[model samples]
Target: MLGRTMYALISLSDLENDFINPYDLTTRLNRFVAVEYGAQFVLTAALLFTGKWFLGVAQLLLTAFLLHSWSVRQHVVDATDVFRQLPLQKKRRLIMFGAFLFCFVMVTYRLIESIIHGLLTDEGRETAKKLFQDAAASLHHY
Candidate 1:
């Protein structure tokens, strides 16, 4: 399950970089900003609901980075130039990427700690139960 979850996350990212951007679907997808922000918020909620608030926060930070990137792209005066980043902007991008690495490390640490300590709060158990029920109910409708 852990391997599958990691694969799904990586695949989603690869969907954009390997396929979406290369095929120039970005313009079609960005027809509405809601498509971008809506996804981030929903995924963040899912992460939080699963007792993974660190991942949720990391998703939010990624959203922030995307917004910053979009702002930089929008400000470009040259029509043909695409997302031309200034040196400082490039540095900031690196910093944000580093932050992502830090968040991933924290997530890994949390998972290991949970496994070693076997500590699940009552609230977390309840949330997990409810989430499982909801997913099961939704699956039945399909």
Candidate 2:
């Protein structure tokens, strides 16, 4: 979605060549950002409700990063005359990128933790064996 916007901004031209219309651009950006926020907010809440605290907090960090990035984008675009915060805006984008990477790490950590937890203990070994048997049975059906 962000790529589409950038492509449009580059390929399309306005009188001033900054944007077709600042307000219209702002509105479109706001709509997508708001929808993304709404979806993630629901996901975070659902995760917490399901007692997935670690995952919920990780998801929350991603959500906050996206929301903050959107706000910075709006601020950059909503400037009346000339927005001279290019460096600061770049920093915000960097932070957003970092947030995505960190979220990836968090998920990987959780996956490894679960796999380890499911491997060491006796009960976990039985559970894992059961899972494999069930999975094999299901595969045989196919």
Scored by TM-score, the top model is 2
**Model 1: how far residue 7 lies from native, Å:** 18
State the displacement of the C-alpha of residue 23, model 1, in Å, after optimal TM-score superposition.
Answer: 14
Segments in model 2 whose C-alpha atoms lie over 4 Å from true places? 1-31, 61-76, 79-85, 116-142
List the candidate 1 regions with Cα displacement exceeding 4 Å. Answer: 1-43, 72-86, 119-142
Ten residues in sequence with the least summed lDDT for candidate 1: 74-83
Each candidate's lDDT (Cα)? 0.54, 0.59
Please give, for residues 1-142, the per-residue lDDT of candidate 2 as tens digits. 2353343244223414664555564454345555556766897899889998977887788777767666666333443422344344445545545655565688789889888886678987888879989999999878
How displaced is residue 2 in candidate 2, in Å?
A: 11
Task: Spell out the clash pairs found in candidate 2.
Answer: none
